[model samples]
Target: MARDRARLGGRRAAGLFAAGTAVALALATGGSLSQAGAATQSDAAAQTAVQAPKATHSQIQLLAINDFHGNLEPATGSGGKINDIPAGGAAYLATHLKELRAAAKAKGQDSVTVAAGDLIGASPLLSAAFHDEPTVEALSGMGLEAASVGNHEFDEGWHELLRMQTGGCLPDGDGQNNQNSCPDPKHPFEGAKYKYLSANVFFTNTQKTLFAPYTIKTFKDGKKVAFIGMTLENTPNIVTKSGVEGLTFKNEVATANALVPELKKKGVKSIVVLLHEGGFPADPKAYNSCPGISGPIVDINAGLDPEIDAIISGHTHQAYNCSLPDKAGKPRLVTSASSFGRLVTEVRLSIDNATGDVDRTNTLAQNQIVTQDVVQDPKTAKLIAKYKALVAPIEGKVIGHISTPSVVRTNDDSLESPLGNLIADAQLADPSVVSAGKAPVAAFMNPGGIRADLASNAGAVTFGQAFTVQPFNNFLVSMDMTGAQIKALLEQQFSGVNGPEAAKYKVLQVAGITYTWNPAAAAGSKVVAGSIKIGGQPLVDGTSYRIVTNNFLSDGGDGFPAFTTATNKVFGGLDIDAFANYLSAHDPYTPVATDRITLGS
Candidate 1:
């Protein structure tokens, strides 16, 4: 619960001194004391002994980070800064965590480092290039004990995620199964030393959780704190459908509630939830302030059992230290560290040894920036350097040129972004002519697949920059769909069953197509009737047209079912390769206008 990081120094010292004085006076008067006086003194001494303060509490430190997304090197542009202070590199993050752990030890506090989730997926090229093996090694080197699994962890599917946990490289299959082995072919991919927790995800056939639901951490004083970890329950809706095919994600609140009694039975009363879901605060400038925090986490926190002392969260990637009340109306600490290792949320919990419960009045949390002022950890730096050397050849090769230092990922009000338009156009231009028989009429790109914005130096865009923008390695796909399905696909962007992230209002970025929509209309019917067209031709509902998209969308990633319904599927080149080819063909490319999809309120 929300409380100051109070010290018991003065008051505890004073009580001990008074007790000592009382004992000395009784000893001095014992010889001259009568028998009845002596008996009375003995009774009083016994009472004093019973009333003396014992070490009935212990303070624990929880160091946490989330949504790292594997930037082994310091992030670039705005991603690397907090208030203009450069922040976040695997090396810097390691140093900060080590310093925090050391400081806690100096204060006689035991510390454990953990992460909320999204630790690996959606990573930049350095880590993503080697299946994020380097990131795992770096975090493991920094002493991360445990972390919750985030939705992005499923980006490469469950088995690959398992490989990240359990050591070893993906077996050599068709190049699709294994991108690369370890960062260095000389050494094997040693998996994460820390454990990953997932309470809610269950296999449909077995109905068993994918990972341990919770783990009990024992401190030096025998005080135990139970940590329950879970990703957002809507994970299935946002991740690719195939990655989580046999898996069913359960309700977050229910998952934790069910585990409370079990933990209590095991004599553990102090509880913390490492949740992979987070909230957005109204104050955009304050990293530690939680003014008007709202999201799925709000409801989840409110529903949690009072036994849970705090929740370290992620996924929304906003930083905040909040005091939220549980179902019992007791203030509980809620926190999140912004993504890409930029910050770490430090939480202190004072637990009562006598009751094995957390002392709610002494719970404290704050987000500490991983500033670049400190010396980087040598071990982490070496790990980064090793990977850098391995990737340098391809990493620095120039793929194309941008007319301006550019980015295409931001959306003001309409969903289409300059980057999205560019990517979609690239896919449309480089269709599967050999397999699909001819070029597709149009292409759609999912916003989630666009990981980073390309910013060129001296107008040159390297493979590393393009790879960072579209690193998923998804294959472009071509298919045939009726005009009715095309219109349905456009309507799917409005929200409802097809929209997993309804709050974000996901809109498809398109090329070779145009549509107008009324925001005031109902969700499923928002796209204006008969307004959808390709190449300025009126659409007949029964007529078929060639459509192109990435494998992820064609398989219904991000809830686009219309894409999955397309007929005569033909897969093409890697999405990144297609984008690179398009850029190469049109060197010195200028940012395209994002005016394809119009919206009217």
Candidate 2:
């Protein structure tokens, strides 16, 4: 029934535009009266007087934000700055949106706000403890129209997302039910007013889309626009496989292009794609404006059909505002607003009345930073305040104590850090983990997942603090790999050598085994052959060895391709649980660098 209504509406809109095209052309031509010498005064007068009957042009403005990750408050101090400009917080974002909307209104334009996904999940204690209900309410208040389903959205699986989408108010941990649990009590999920587009995600059993493939929105001026949303096709690899067990993500480019003909049949010529994947700036340190750089975005953009007028992307978390040529050499406007509500990408488009197409002649695209100079929206501010108060009792409730400071860093500076060693030790102790098979051997953790540093000051570490360090809830998996695979994995870590972002590719802290290597060795052959071992026993080249690590590396994240071909793979163990259990079993334990690895002497 909705399809029938939309199709009818699209046809009517197309007919209206066709009738008005002549008048629009006349009005456009009349503005150049000063150039009458080039065309005869009579011709100019005729063009000005005979305006097409339905001649009217529509200007549409699209505003996008991505990776909110449920941060309701401003991220101040360190770790949140862009070009020295402080950014983020819903209140600040609201202020920016209001100004952008007013500017569009002043220019007689229609506007819609959308997101590229990851609006929730891995949230702060304020929202996560409350089941992310407050975050949903905040988004509703922000008036988010449409969003692509980011990987984090599935953290709690599809059932939870559906509840967040259609239900009203989430329950607080307190036995008492509170109406204020969600800010907008009247319409808690109202902000999800716009449909969630999932062009590529489909259910395996039914072979059908769980959500709408795309959405066709009609403007007051009889202009119809279509938006298609998709995340990176590799979502299954990043997310818990069980969470999406019954679904499959198709090829992004193939899914988007397949929908184009259907949209065109519905008389929608102005098309926009909201892909949840973004490109990394070629230079790792280059925070802004890296042009013609190559990464995931390069392949995805080049593969996109010319019919796609604009592409709003996120995931890589880098920001870029530039035009990359499509297969046909026609410039495709691609923009990524930095993550955590730091920026908003705005695309201004003009529609052609003749063929219902965007006026590719003049399209403007740019990313505007959401600076702290703007005031926070009072309503959003209050919502954050309410949640903070609700979680206050448990926010600082220390669950355990540490004897010494555990330094946490992501680069080579993290070698044998106390905190990393502690985490690696915990993974090895968990009997449920494959790495723990028969007394276990060693455990490895990616540095990217550890988000905080354990302060050496004599303070208790709370559940909240531990969660912040390991937010993804990744499960600990154990597998058996030949000694050759271990060496290959280490070498893969340095594959980015001589590349712009080489520093990022370096491995950090390791547990259970220590090895020394020469950075001067060949990229693929860097790991010293004899230096590898487990528990002081030399790794047998032909023998299979049990290894413990998270699912991220097991599936080849962070360029660890060697693990993908492991012969014996096991699963269903939560790494966070292992860490928590280990902490519980060994309170007051202090980590020390116990010869896990040694630098080449």
Error of model 2, residue 461, in angstroms: 3.6
lDDT of 1 by residue, 1-601 (tens): 1111100000000011111222223334443212322332344445345332237767688899999988788888888887777889999888988888898898888999888998987788778777888889999999999999999888777877888899897554412322456545678988999899999988896768888988899888688888898999988777766677788899999999999999999988889999999888777546654656778888899999888988899999888764565677666777888989988887767677778677654555557888887888999999988878877776788988999778669864667889998998899988443362567888899888887787787899988888888877777788899999988888788776545445666788899998888877988888888778897887779999888888778877677888878888886777788888899998989988877888774
- Compare the candidates by TM-score and give the number of the best one: 1
lDDT of 2 at 528: 76
Model 2 C-alpha lDDT per residue in residues 28-60, reported as the tens digit of each score:
455321232223222434433332222345667
Residue range with the least summed lDDT across 10 consecutive positions in model 2: 1-10
- Whole-model lDDT per candidate: 0.77, 0.67
Give the poorly placed runs of model 2, Cα more than 4 Å off. Answer: 1-56, 76-78, 168-191, 282-289, 400-406, 413-418, 429-438, 455-460, 477-509, 517-525, 541-547, 551-595, 598-601
Looking at model 1, the pairs that clash are 408-419
Output the lDDT of residue 337, model 2. 77
lDDT at 444 for candidate 1?
92
